[model samples]
Target chain A: MTQTSKKPAAVEALGLTKIYGSGNTEVIAMKEVSLSLARGEVVALLGPSGAGKSTFLTAIGLINPPTAGRIVIGGEAVMDGPRALVDLRAFRRRHLGFVFQKANLIPFLKAVENVAIAMEINDVSPRAARKRALELLDYLGVGDRARNLPDALSGGQQQRVAVARALANQPSLILADEPTAALDSHRGRQVMELFRQVAHEHGSAVIVVTHDHRSLDVFDRTYEMEDGELGAKHSPPAPTANSTPSA
Target chain B: MNLAAKDIRHNLGRFVLTAIGIGLLLMTVLGMSGIYRGMVDDAMVVVDRIGADLWVVQHDTRGPFAEISRVPANLEHRVRAVPGVASARSFVSHNVQREHRDEPLRMNVHGLAWPEDNGAWVTLTAGRPLGQAHYELIADASLGLALGEKLKLGKDTYTVVGIAKGMVSSGGDGLAFFTTQDALAIQVDLPGDALRLERAARVQRAVAQDLGQVQPLLLERGAGMASGIPALGPPMVSAITVRVAEGVDAAQVAATIAAWPDVSVHTRDDQEALLVRGMIDKARRQIGLFRVLLVVISTIIMALILYTLTLDKIHDIAMLKLMGARNPMIAGLILQQALLLGALGYGIAWVLGGWVFPRFPRRVLITSEDLWALAVVVAIISVFASLLGIWKAMRVEPNKVLA
Candidate 1:
């Protein structure tokens, strides 16, 4: 799992390092972190608080640039040591999707609008974007809640809508930061299984930063992080019935 | 779908209330301009109605309106003998205050030369122009005088023969028109005891002079004749209003009259300029300052409102940025909201003005040009006010969403 894929990897980060301040105030957030993920795979990142998991995730997400690193997505070198080879904002818009713990759906927009806007900003036609958004919501089992606002939806339903929004642009990489932290055990496992299903079926790579270990078996591989360094990966457990939705 | 429109729909109550608040402010700004127009219009009302080609006043004076001007009553005869003169009539004006029906009544009295000037040019809303040489007057409707109403001024009771509309002096007092003889009578009328005191004083003054000492019998004859009798041929008038021949240039006629050292000559345009610029210059400046101050206050208020609204949406803004929304798109949201607010407020101001302006003590005249200019100014203000909100939105860090 540590070796690079023969087929083009969906995400490849080489010796990524992030440093904050210098001299007396110098602090290193992440040190020489390398990660690779094949297409159609879901990976779990587990860590204690302030262990640099978020720093590493943000670096790969192109939101926060690493001080020294090479980031390649879909076989193209996008970021080189805090310098961007392409327009980072446009690249992020067209190729990456993000889901936060709070769902982060625009409060004023309905569920379908929230998802459709993600694709529309990428220059997709409104009608096609809406149609794709509805289809994604249906695939995630939140089709009936398409007209509801974020506040009107339950915790599990809101997370499902968020997932549908992340899949709106058919992105190559999906990054989720503790997406299930606000949900109960039953709802949290349901969200984690949805990520696995999204990766396996849509041929996109998925990485979830989570503290919950009860649903780690849903991922294809797991990596524990501490002291700003990523540990060795662990093999996934056998398929369990709990991975499937109860309802 | 328009993001700004959707947000407004989401919070329609707050948006509408905000627009109403802005509308009242805009109304005050618009009213300042209206009041300025009203002042200018009011100051020129009498000057316009007279329709004189040239005005002959006391030498070196701007008046009959801007300053007090008095010339000999027979100046019209001299002005008529000038080349290109069509007709000239004596005019006299003064302000009178007295009690009528237990309420204090104030009017600017204009005396028209009888036979030669019947006040036919005055626009009448009711009743006919002066039909008699005495005891008949035309009063502006602003004075609350009705047609055929008898008003007692001095010892004579004058009948309201006509009613005029929008006829007011530069000071906003309603105008009343009467024949020169009747107006002079009202000026000279006095109480019996005061008349006796004046005659005794006139006799004493004559006795002090050599003529009175040599002819005491002549002084006694003059005292018995009338109170303060001077035996002058006629009373002096305020000015002479001249109408030149149709084909004759008024300025040339005015220049001819100006050559006479006894009186100053002003063409109709010059008279209007003097009334507007010299009479109401301070009022104009005061209104202009108020208009500018209101616009500045409106801009600041709008900026603060927009800034507060932007703060309310910081979380949403950060989320949009993370979702890859462009800076222009985000900025457009704030700009559209500001413009909508301005448009709504402007509309409400017009509606409010329509209901309220007619009731004002002074006239409020609104021109189409003024309306269009205000609209353009409001649009510009909206854009400027949105800048503060746009700056705040641009500084939002997308990484904040993850935290």
Candidate 2:
């Protein structure tokens, strides 16, 4: 499939810093981090343990307000120097989605309910939420598993369901932390390809924090982080003859 | 909207266990409340059953049932002659013991005038009312007295002519109905030796005359030698129960009698208030204490249960928060679950209290209004209980999902 990447940047963060305590005992999780990602683009953030990759992801995802920074999402300057211009939670709900290391689906709910919960939280009616949830699941190729629970699905299927749930609200950006850490290389690569497809087709800016390098070529652009600072950026490697198309 | 149903489904075992525990506590609260109502009902049973509008007793006393009251038997005649007084009857009440199949039974003896005897307070599960005033008694079946059985009361042997049911005093003592004469005999009659001793003491007092009476005093003044015939004193009665005439205000009549120096009258409302104060006051306070304690305990248990459940799902809550779920949505979920638990607990308690309370030795009455009041009370408690969990859940940082 021919992939055209021409969308402009959807999120930009400059000099982001997070500090935990005052004078006597202070801890800094992330310091002076700058990043930007365009819409319809998928990027991979590679880092070692305790390298502030998770902190940077959370700061950009609007889950935690950076101590000092300028954050612009979907062309809106929402955060400036620790002050949020709009309702942080509401802005996040409308513009952002999140995927954790685990599927993190609500266990009591069925696969469809898991996805529908996101819509309901945003005040979507039950009928509309259910319809949208099923449509998203069908688009993600998991409509047949709508009635099953998270535990009933395989690891790969669970992560796919999680991806469907993240896209349920049609967010403009998606932040995933270790989304493919629990899957085999093939399944991890497959999930990586799905994220690429979602970012391009749905026009979302996708940033995935992963330790796996087997699916490095699946992303449009990749960046590395070491000790809370972004390293050199790299382009996707050219497609190889053995690069099998993912289903 | 709120994920309350989902939360309960997720932790069903814990939810059900907590509900059952709450149900048992609620059952206790409901039962105690019912018992309080029953006490009021029991205290009013005799008055309601007798259908009397006014009661006359000695001055400065509440009544025959609440306190000791005695008046001249002739007072009934005088009261019957009063305007708007349809009729008056004498009644005597005293606690007495009798033998039932070789086992002693404690009971309250109510003496009624012949033909003026009101029927039993409750339907007889087995026998009938006494047809004759003499040598016959209507006994509660709870007293274990069989029909046709002869029971010895102080010095008189009374045949159990009929069996009654639910004829119990407010103190839970069974009742037996007899003629006024028998009750007086049992209450006032003394042994021959005791009577002789009293006459001897009086004779000695009369013989020791004052020296100021210089003339020879007549020996007839002595107790032993009777003056022509001993003056007959009026018979004493416990109380006079009066039925007010149609269209007459019983309160007004009571006020009229209150003006008399040696007599006091009580309207139905006054008697009912006094009965409630005297018989059920302490029990009501005790039930109130139980209700307060149960509420405190239930609130604590619910708070702890909810807190634990919230703590258990901290990660899930954090993830939901990270996914942009609002504080109100999360809070609503917890509150809704608490309300559902409360409703379930109350439903179980209603059934349990209804089934088990009436079987107690004392009466227990449950009413729809009481249930409604309790439901509202439980709902308020549930809201308070959920506050802790909601606060904890809302305070959870979405960033914690990363940790």
Candidate 3:
């Protein structure tokens, strides 16, 4: 039963450290944080303000490089410290997905086009890509707003379209930062459940940075961060004052 | 998706306003070139109308337009007698002004040595040409002269006998043709004050000789010298235009006459060059400088607009970079938008130039070849202008999206 339950890890980081500036003004944003996430698992990262949550998210997302670390994604070793082992841009496009605090949809494009362009950049055929985009939107329950621009959609609907975009390439790992911060409690909890469903249904690993404690129960595992350090696993942990909880 | 096009459509009003501003500048650039072309045409039309193979004038002078030239009217016979010289005619040209209903009308006076068949030069659109009378005149239609209207030239009245079309002078003024004899009378004939003074002096000298106040033989000699042989003021003809016979080279004949230090002879090409290059040189330079100024102004405006537009969308550019968009792709977006702006501006200028040019007092001429050449120049300019925006875009940090 234990052998059957074991799954390959999607992301692995060893001794990840991120330092900013130098000399007297220097400060460590993330400190020797080692973490691992497995396929079909959804994890939540909760932190106080300046708790290094964004630093960890960006480092693993391949945007900002870590000061010292060994990082791997989808069984491929990609980085050593700040140096990249492969072309980072191609690596990110093929293996990783990211969602920001806001939907950040391209204003000029409709929801379907916004979703499809993410695939198009990967050299996917426009017709096939658009068909897949429609399917993803339907799966995310925003198919009715496929032709509407981001400005025309509600906050939750926009986030759904953004999630559809993030999933267009079927990436092995997803990193989201405050994906439901702008939504109401009902919508935020719904978005959190959607992330949980995405991780389980696609057999993908997901890491979400959030302060919404009400939805923390939806995650498979929860980690808390403070003063640039990750705390122990929690049956439950109260959010700090620096953390902004919607409800 | 064509990101640049979608953005432009999203901001259609701002894009249109920018295009209009650039289009007006392009229109002025095109119009200046057209005006230069028109001026060249105006300068050559009179010489072309003469249809003479050679132009003979005073030594070291370009002739009627570039400098004052005085060649004797009798020289026409000698030029006609030259080998290969088919025929020759004396021509007097000058700028004159006459009053009509209290408005001063400026015109060019062409003194034609009459009794020749050169009447075929002018294409009459109304009325008949001059009779043998000295006061009869053939006028250019642009002069707005009606048939039988009287024009006062120096103390003489001329009736407009015919109207000719497009017969303007080198300076773009309307033309009037008269007999050389009549033109000499109008230009060099003594003014009323001088004529009266001369008569009074002659009367006083005659009375002195009659009263034995002076020697009669000396008086007779002086009177014979000043005799009624009609006192002449200045030479009548400004130049002589000569035609060459069939099977003869005009240059060969011009070289033959050029041997005489007292005269300078020129072939058709020499005259055209003198008028187009020498006469229109300064005007061309002025128009060329103005055109260059307009191009520079347009380039600067385009670059500024592109930079501003790029700044406004810096967030979007950063997102694209984060999504794995390459440098070429971002640069291409900026470059493509600049090119579209140039193309739209050019099209607008072409239409506007055609509609506005004719109403100008001076002639304006544009050709398709000029338009194609300008299009190439404009395309190059757009590419260079987009570089500013591309550089700004390339500097966008993909990591900015995280913050």
Best by TM-score: 1
Winner on lDDT (1 vs 3): 1
Query: Taking the candidates in order, what DockQ does each have?
Result: 0.68, 0.60, 0.58
Q: Which digits, one per residue and each the tens of the lDDT, describe model 3 over residues B1-403?
A: 7888988987889988998888888989899898888888878877888888998999999987788998878888889889999989988888888688788898888877786843556889988766774888899887889998998878888888889887777677888888888877777756777776666676567667654355455434434423342443335488999989999987789899999888998877888998878888889999999998988888998899988988887888887777777778789889989999999889888988889988877778787877987798789878888989999999998787765
lDDT at B187 for candidate 2?
78
Residues B332-400 of candidate 1: C-alpha lDDT, one tens digit per residue: 999999999999989988889878888887778887877888899899999999999999999998898
Per-residue alpha-carbon lDDT of candidate 3 for residues A45-110, written as tens digits (9 for 90 to 100): 898889999998888888889999878888888889999998888887777777888988888889
Instruction: Point out the worst 10-residue segment of candidate 1 chain A by lDDT.
Output: A1-10
Give the DockQ-based CAPRI class for model 2. medium
Give model 1's TM-score versus the native structure.
Answer: 0.95
* Model 1 stretches with alpha carbons more than 4 Å out: A1-7, A245-247, B184-194, B221-233
Winner on DockQ between 1 and 2 is 1
lDDT of 2 at B60: 91
Best by lDDT: 1
- Residue-level error in angstroms, candidate 1, position B381: 0.5
Interface RMSD of each: 1.0, 1.5, 1.1
